[model samples]
Target: MVSDTLKAVMQKEGVVAIVAQGKAFPHVVNTWHSYVSVGNDSFIVPVGGMHGMEEALNHDNRVLVTVGSKEVEGLHGMGTGFLLSGHAKMISDGEEYALMKKNYPWARAIMNITILNAIQTV
Candidate 1:
């Protein structure tokens, strides 16, 4: 289950650490911008400027997401963060995509993450 603290961090910061990797390359990008939880293990994050993600998204469907603390509240000096492992599916048109568009009107796509694990610090 995704803890309340993690969700709080996501809601409070609206950014996440996304890592996409393939056999020959690894890419990390912060905030395609606008992330929201649909359920305990499901989330939708808008993606823009996807040039860096194209290779990984094509070679793999799994992605790593880290949220909270330094990435979310670094400027505010908040402590800790969480890690989420999940499968991501790209969507350009759908209910989730519509919501993504509502939240980030300029986003080119939406990544629906079906979280399988949640790791956090005390």
Candidate 2:
């Protein structure tokens, strides 16, 4: 499940990175997303991207996401950010897919990332 703090930060900062494991290095794609809760400890984030996102997922299901804001200042003028690591399943069907399609009509594919860990400093 997504913690209230993380969810709040995500809501405040709607954009995040979907980083997938690559052969040489991690492939990162920035995207706008909508956060969803499937159940306890089962959080989902739907993202829209071109071929890279889909291709990366094909290579490895494990992914990492970095969220939060760089412009927002904290107590000590530090940037607020969060890192979410987890596994994701590529979805082209079902309600989540449909919703993603509806939200992002030009999206090539929709990735439903199940967040395993969420760390935030905001």
Candidate 3:
């Protein structure tokens, strides 16, 4: 579960990194984007590239997400870490895909991510 404060932090500082285990080796890809909470314990992150990045998604679906912001004044600041466990599936549903596509015009395609797990970092 994510607290209101943590969620706020994520909104400010969040980076989604995707890692896939390929046939020969493991490859990693990352990007920065806006993330929003879709449910009580779920978050949706739009991932671009529908066909070109198919290989990466097929190989592996494990992803690592980190969220945090810089310190201000004398306040003690810390970052939170979340390990997401969900497979990357291409948006096939037209209506749903269209909605995602509408938000990201620059992306060739988009994939909706359903967060499975979230953990706080020490």
Ranking by TM-score: 1, 2, 3
| Worst lDDT 10-window in candidate 3 | 68-77
lDDT of each: 0.72, 0.65, 0.54
Per-residue alpha-carbon lDDT of model 1 for 1-122, expressed as tens digits?
77666666666655677787866877777772235545788877677776667567778878888776554433336666777888877788978788768878988887788899887743
The local lDDT score (0 to 100) that residue 19 gets in candidate 1 is 81
Q: What's each prediction's TM-score?
A: 0.79, 0.74, 0.66
Count of backbone collisions in candidate 2 = 1
Tell me the tens digit of each residue's lDDT in model 3 across 3-118: 66555555664565655566677566566636443445555545554343457667666544555444211123454444555555545547765676677655544555556666
Best by lDDT: 1
TM-score of predicted structure 1: 0.79
- Which lDDT tens digits does candidate 2 get at residues 33-79? 34443444554545554466667777888988777755555435655
Better of 1 and 3 by lDDT: 1
lDDT of candidate 3 at residue 112, scale 0 to 100 = 53
